[model samples]
Target: MQKIRAVVFDAYGTLFDVYSVTARAEQLFPGKGEALALLWRERQIDYTRIRSMAAPDGAYYKPFWALTVDALRYAAERLQLLLDPALEAQLLKEYACLSAFPENLGALKRLRAAGLPLGILSNGNPQMLDISVKSAGMHGLFDHVLSVDAVRMYKTAPEAYALGPKAFGVPAGEILFVSSNGWDACGATWYGYTTFWINRAGHPAERLDVSPSGTGHDMNDLLEFVRTQGAAV
Candidate 1:
């Protein structure tokens, strides 16, 4: 394999714990927190996929922040929870600064020290990505924080994956694309990027024909994978 020149990560479930909002959610909704968090995440991704499928050219694009709010409202309604404006605002605030995974900063620092360019290719809007990176204390770790909003399309779409190589100025094959979502890994693979699936939950792989070049559970494992790939991280 060509030496990995740049590492691009998916933001939500890979580096940041999207479910970290559950604590604030529990404080507000008591027993429905976990369910709401899970369902909300599901619906958020679903909406992105629906939008992309409905308009591959991004004719139906909505910013990720708006989709997130819509998904939360839908989840709450499905659970029969009363999500008034104030409560909804609180949840959205928490989501804006979701917690980083415990192992992320250390691993990213090591990669950066090795002179490897690191970046984020996420569905988040630029403002959302900036705030989350700052909130997680990961402000200077990445060389780029790319958003699909540029193309107005979400991931699993070729346009979204293309941003990484374009931003890094490298061929897709030389950029190591890491994502926690199995489907996302598959998408990156299909896009011709060397992919790693961070299966943090140990979930089964997607049935998609494409598979990631590697798999692991956390940033530490990602560091090790980088080493094995001939990157001196």
Candidate 2:
């Protein structure tokens, strides 16, 4: 196996947690934080799927913030939260400063110090992704922050897979694509990446047409793999 030059990460869920937004929502909306948050996230991803399958080439990629607001609105209305525009903005802003797992920083530091390039291939809009990387204290850690907004499709889509080579200037084979979703790991794996699935949920693998390079319970196991980044031929 060839050495991996750049490691790319999916921002939300993989690196940053969206639950922080809902945790804050507990103050603004009563009794519906968890359910509202779950619904909001589910609907946000649903919106992306609907938009993607609609003509697939319609130059109609909505930004992450728009989806965030729309999903929030949909969830709020259904749950009867009635969040004002001001409160909504506050929640979105709150999302920008989410903290990451302590292991993320230490582990990434080891990778960088080992001279491997690091980048982000997230589904967030560029601005939102930027805030997330920075707030998580990872601004200087990544060589690039690539978002799906440019391609008008979300991750697990072919368009998102294409961004890896475009942003990193390397062929897919040399890029280690790390994501939390099994389908995403498989997507990039089939797309030719040396993939790693961060199976944080312990969820069983979804039936997929492609196989992944590895699957681990968390980033630390990923670090164990990284320690041998250049060891394999």
**Residue 3, candidate 2: C-alpha displacement in angstroms:** 2.1
Deviating ranges (above 4 Å) for candidate 2:
228-233
Q: Which 10 consecutive positions of candidate 1 have the poorest summed lDDT?
A: 18-27
- For residue 218, model 1's alpha carbon misses the true position, in angstroms, by 0.8
> Using Cα atoms with residue i matched to residue i, what is each candidate's TM-score against the true structure?
0.97, 0.91
Clashing pairs in 2: 1-233
Write the residue-wise lDDT of candidate 1 on 133-225 in tens digits.
Answer: 999899989999999999999998999998999999999999999999999999999999988999999999999877899999888888889
Q: Using alpha carbons, what is the TM-score of model 2?
A: 0.91
What TM-score number comes out for model 1?
0.97
Q: Which has the greatest lDDT? A: 1
Cα lDDT over the full model 1: 0.92
Cα lDDT tens digits for candidate 2, 158-195: 88888988888899898899988787888889888999
**What Cα-based lDDT does every candidate model obtain?**
0.92, 0.82
Query: CA lDDT of 202 in candidate 1?
Result: 95
